[model samples]
Target: MVVPVPPPPLLASHVAVRAAASAISHGRRVLLNGDHPPQVAALGRGDWVKLICGASFEDAADVRNLSLVYTLAGVDCIDCAADASVVGAVNEGIEVAASIVPTVQRPWLMISVNDDCRDLHFRKAEFDPDDCPLDCSKPCEKVCPADAISLKHSMVDGERTLSDPLRGKYEGGVITERCYGCGRCLPVCPYDRIRAVSYVRDPTMTAELLKRDDVDAIEIHTTGKGTDMFNTLWDNLSGSINNVKLVAVSLPDIGESTVDLMNTIYTIMEPHFKGYNLWQLDGRPMSGDIGRGATRETVSFAAHVASMSERPPGFYQLAGGTNSYTVDYLKKAGLFQSSNWNSGTATSEMASSHQALIGGIAYGGYARKIVGRVLRKIPEQFGRVHIEDHPDHLLEALQEAMSLVGPVKGYIPSHSKPFMKQVDRQ
Candidate 1:
């Protein structure tokens, strides 16, 4: 008997689109985090939400889809790799999202690069599968969040023996393009085969990408080893510094020296830094997808930085271990938007500014894992499928994105209210 094929995917009706758009506006309008739009009041109100596309995650298709979904969810920025193709993918996704919801704010596009090779975000996992025992169970593949690893075995000569170590060949290894160097797979390899290879991004190419109009921000990942490398990289990009609207420096906690390093870095940027600056307190570093425990380090980092009497001159944001539980953690820590805590070095001015002590949060691995579920449901044949092309998936993805973003923005449930009309766009 022959089976009938399923119907073509249905597009969302105009009414459905309007409802989705209305929900977004309502959510933004009612955000308890602050009364201002996240982009305008993010730093001040501590409600900025940035979608990190992984500094090393170069998957164009995934990046584009994530951009579109998060844009509709109302994030303030989308942080991605510094490559030209990746930037194009992010812009393409943002434009598509705007097309769908016309009034959706165009989030600032930020590119990430590292000054030092030792930084974990600038690495990739590598190993040779040929040396592996055929019978070995692959835990690396199972632990990988990005699905960067693949292995397949086949019987030779259509025969197998218990003693035959070479009975089959492993067909696939790490897909370099998909690997974001999260380092999760490095520890799970029982054979001790997997190792991380680190590299610094080229300054020339980064400067060139900064000149593009679509690019609005730049994140420089530093190892806090010292200011030597950061100074060099900063000087290299000074020529193109005016090209973007904001500059963000991502660094880890190095104890007492952390504040000093931040101050020094700020001094470096102060002369040429015409745009807004933010300090990314990367606590646990790329562990957001692990679980609840991962979020603590970042929250702790924010609290630690918030209490500091001499932090620096810039917005402070949490990263590395951020997840859905982060906002609650921040609220509990009294750092969410407390005006009492002073983080910046300009104590008098900062106190008067009345901006939220902790600016906002950036979601990376955890963000992808949530919406990625719906994206994975789409069939492989529909390569490079725009989330908007499949409105059902787009709406589902938007819902997932909002679940994580809304709480931070103080979104109230619109359970009883009638759907509002869509806003008129310029």
Candidate 2:
């Protein structure tokens, strides 16, 4: 009698991929059955999850992969750079996800722009690798969460070897497209060679993007120092403001004046705010990948905002340093999807109507970090990696993404072992 043969690794992975895709589809179908658009209802119910592709991160391939993974995992929105190419990348990812899972709901495509050049989200780290000392320990590479820095020592001449002192040069520096201005590399560099270059998004270009049919939301990053810059930027985009389904303002906690600033910004937006609005309470911007502690600031910011009686109108959400611990923190603070909010506040109406006090969470660095680990496993030999093309890698990445997105969506994967392993590893 002939012995039975086991399936090859590729075929096994393909079966696993199908299983993962089915699980994701089931979760979305369960969460999205309400009368309201799934995103809006999620906002009302406080289970909304958004994937923030960094405001300055413009690597199209990476963005596309990230968008695909998060979209499959059932995020309500995808926030990405305002650049045309970046927006295209996000849509491409979403489209690919839809083709793979025919029933997947298309997430809102949101573009992120900044009013001030000083805003940390609108910058990139720069350094001249050739200037790096041959003997220097490259802490920048190790500390960078984005893997944006690359360095290699090369011989200076035909006679000199890489081992010869002062005979080689550092050939690679910050990969600008991959750098999202985290600034972790700045302080760690012994030579102080790294510099952050900041920029403001062009309003004309942004206005044109808003006119696109696929774009669904816009997030304006403000420093909260004053409203002059905010007013100016808003005026520039006023003509196209009505095109989006949602408008978000991302700002940091500025002590006692935080609520006052939010009200002022709301006042500025009231007239043209024809759609739903959200307040992104950014705690420690771009630090989510650090560890569990990074999520605290955002959670604290949410609690502070939730307690305010005079806060502005609009759904409230947490961002900046959000991670796996954010929901637990919110639950501990009595704010996760809790209809019982602090009484007699501007948000009381939402509470009485059974909407959640805190709308949801936006995972940026932490979200990317989890899935990126799986992405990095994809061989560089396969240039311009479309994640869906590699079923094995895609299955692994989907598992990693679901680990972060599942809890918020109340999704329990058919195979819990891989999901639990990812959560514990993180």
lDDT of 1 at 156: 73
Computed on alpha carbons, the lDDT of every model, listed in order, comes to: 0.82, 0.83
Query: Can you give the lDDT of residue 378 in candidate 1?
Result: 85
How much lDDT does candidate 2 score?
Answer: 0.83
For all the candidates, what are their Cα RMSDs to the real structure? 6.7, 6.4
Worst 10 contiguous positions by lDDT, candidate 2:
343-352
* C-alpha-based local distance difference test score of model 1: 0.82
TM-score of 2: 0.90
lDDT of 2 by residue, 1-426 (tens): 999553234344545554566666665533333445678778777888999999999999999999998887889999999999999999989987776666677999999999999999999999898889988889999999999999887766575555575667888999999999989998999999999999999999999999999999999999988999999999999999999888899999998999999889988988876788888999999998888898888899988987888887778889988888887887888888787344322321332366677888999999999899998998999988988878778877888788788777777532243643333221
RMSD of 2: 6.4
